[model samples]
Target: MINTFTKPKRLYQEIGLRLYEELSDSRFSVGDRLPPERDIAERLGVSRAVVREALIMLELMGLVEVRKGSGIYLIKQPTDNSLNNELESTLDNDDVGPFEMMQARQLLESHVAEFAATQATKKDIIKMREALELEKQNIEVLDHNHDADKLFHLAIAEATQNSVLVDLVENLWERRESSPMWKQLHCHITDQTYRKKWLIDHEEILLAIQQKKPDAARMAMWRHLENVKDTLLILSEHKDPSFDGYLFSSNPVQI
Candidate 1:
């Protein structure tokens, strides 16, 4: 315990360790349903997104089960050995939170879209269209790497004629690709409706750039990212009253 903060654990890891420790109490046992996300969030002094990530980590560690319509249940009793093992394996996870990543992209990419509106050439427009066509072909597939989506965004960054911007955008995408937290959270989202909306968003963004509408391009890109973040957050909401939109009616964590 003396070295708990020695490695500087990430927020989700810290929260997850605390929750896992609580499972060791006599009041908790295998098969007991844990509290709702909102309740856990409030008590932990963190947002529901943070709580969701922590829960996902716990589920990945095999300590908890998240049933879609039912609340989270303890699937295994936590032991110090198991806790330290899982903690050692995942405590080094300093990757950006999915929502946090989206926020960064929204801020940076919206401005990039605006800049692209002024710098885009016929070649760039053609590249964007090709990416869109590929995206259109893959729209119905829910479990791919989203390569076309990446190409579309990278094409916009390239339109700026700045290698630094391209590197920055590419770096962000690569980070997202490598994030374990992102993968785990995405595994819980089953809805494909949002992908179609995103394709529509890409078309709107391309059109804005083609027309050289800087403001419209920025706004379209901004709105697209906001919708994406919202959809992912909504689709990943599993367990408790929140699973079906009854976010305010779930039970609090049992002490």
Candidate 2:
């Protein structure tokens, strides 16, 4: 008998949902081998590509393990890490603004700093201090080293003692590499004085966290983001026409 299921409008999502449902059945226990791609495509009346896409989604959700030569197997039940999921979503959107990115960083990193203050081990604190020192040196050279900046942030995230938050912060930094605002800000602000000021602000943030003061850390992050916002606004006003609605909108936090 022919299966009567029609192909889904969004093939990837439809395939993902179908795979998710199939995997959810108790019969598909952990480590159970999944049917081959061809078999799945035939059974679902969809192309092999759709099945593959679905499988990728399943892998991302932590539902299945894909072994190159051994085929796919059920791994474990899926668990959502909200911060990682949000970072992934933000990375996928091309129009994400600086404000939105800052807002996300503000929400996630402020809490991360607070946690890091309480949870940081000696090694974590040492790494953070090292990163801060590197940032300080870079400021003297007036170099806009995105890598160093990201490393500093990642060190703070690591101090939180949360792997999930570390991953989220890393992902956000990756997204920033392609961000229009990031590119523009680097081009517009190239002075050593500005770099020194930014480094000093970061130092204050680190000091607050080192003191294990949650409130101080949160306020420091807020002030730093506010400074970033002001800098971006000044640049946007001078060069860019702001004709693109995406550039001027203030939904920095909601994205």
Candidate 3:
């Protein structure tokens, strides 16, 4: 029998490692404008969202700067210590509870949904609709494509025209992807009913945002995430043998 299994690393960490290798080999120089996100996605065989997440990590480490409406550009003279330290510190905090992270996500993403209701444009609405259609098709397959789910949420954040919130949500999703609890949830959540319910919740939020109903959108998103929180809490408790109570029982940190 051929053993088939895979080790897990955060998407951004993998991207960061590849970037570090390139920088070390002088494949890209300081001040060089990195290719557009789509181009990088093609080159790396990863989704544009993954590239964007990686770029955010790079930006956080001061290795690159993203200029809105321009493009990402290399910044630091290639050095190992700061970038390595940043990555290490990020990876080292692996013990943080999943519910705690979900609480943070709920607080930030709900606000973004509210802002998106007020700020989204006609173009943004169209993009959101397209994402929803894709989400509907994907959910029908009952596949656990967290990346697809993430894109739907990120599209809403992007529509908010709030770069800070967009960056924050992207980083949050990246961190969530690294958690074993999240991995376990993905494995257990194979039911089409569960998938469809999430899709319906996404559509409800999108409709509120489309109508520019800020309060409605905010509440819808809050309700949707509350469901997510509840499901995660249940799954984390039931499935993961090593999970401590914090993964399920902790209350949200008041913002």
Candidate 4:
């Protein structure tokens, strides 16, 4: 017997489809709230990031609504297959704004930085130093090394010693890599000065974490993302009118 059933291509997609089925089957009617992200993640043996991403996808499909500080609720009995079809064919870069992605990162990584600072071991700090050194070296080359930058962030997440937080950081990085919109937006923004500024921000974050200052770590992470959002907004505006649709603010995003 030849078994040909393959797993879903993406973990979040698999989780999203299963969540759709569960929502359809459950007694919870339209307007009823779904389980919390942590609850859902625990029930399914997945990371909170996986659940969060699935929820975002479902919201885009018009199957559910997310009321921040309240909860996620089922808004419609059925989702639009047209949206799904469009997603299958190609994702519209406009569908996800750079501001939106940065907002999500701000929410997750601020807390992650806090936790990593509080819980980081001596070895963890060493690993982070190594990543930082690599980032510095990579930035000098003609071709930028995104992997080194990624490693630095991942090292901070690793310091947390919480599997879920680690997963969330990794998930965010993966999404950034895979997002066409992110690539398009960055193409217009990235330059030597921008890279140098980011490296300095990374160093500030690293210093706070190494010193075991949770508050400082959180603020450092928040400020770094805020700067990133600001720069992206400026570049996005210059590149396309579609980016003007994204809400912009000089004030920092509140998580």
Please state every model's RMSD to the true fold in angstroms. Answer: 5.5, 16.7, 16.8, 12.7
Candidate 1 least-lDDT 10 residues: 246-255
**Candidate 1 pairs with clashing backbones:** none
Any runs in candidate 1 off by more than 4 Å, and if so which? 1-9, 140-145, 242-255
For model 4, the stretches where C-alpha displacement exceeds 4 angstroms are 1-96, 239-247, 250-255
Summing lDDT over every window of 10 consecutive residues in candidate 2, give the lowest-scoring window.
238-247
Preferred candidate (lDDT higher): 1 or 4: 1
Model 4 — TM-score against the truth?
0.59
TM-score of each: 0.87, 0.55, 0.56, 0.59
For candidate 1, the clash count comes to 0
Candidate 1 lDDT, tens digit per residue, 1-255?
234532525677778777866876545888998988887878998877677778888887888887887878998887667666666677776777777678789889999999999999999999999999888888755546599999999999999999999999999999999988789888887777678899999999999999999999999999898888778878887647654343222212211
Off by over 4 Å in 3: 1-92, 188-192, 236-255
Candidate 2 runs further than 4 Å off: 1-93, 239-255
lDDT of 4 at 229: 75
Please write out the lDDT profile of model 2 over residues 142-199, one tens digit for every residue: 6667466677789889988789999998888788787653553344343335556667
lDDT sort, best first: 1, 4, 3, 2
Error of 3 at 174 (Å): 0.8
Q: Over all chains combined, what TM-score does candidate 3 have? A: 0.56
Q: Is candidate 2 or candidate 4 better by lDDT?
A: 4
Query: Against the hidden true structure, what lDDT does model 1 obtain?
Result: 0.82
Residue 150's C-alpha lDDT in candidate 4? 84
What is the lDDT for 19 in model 2? 68
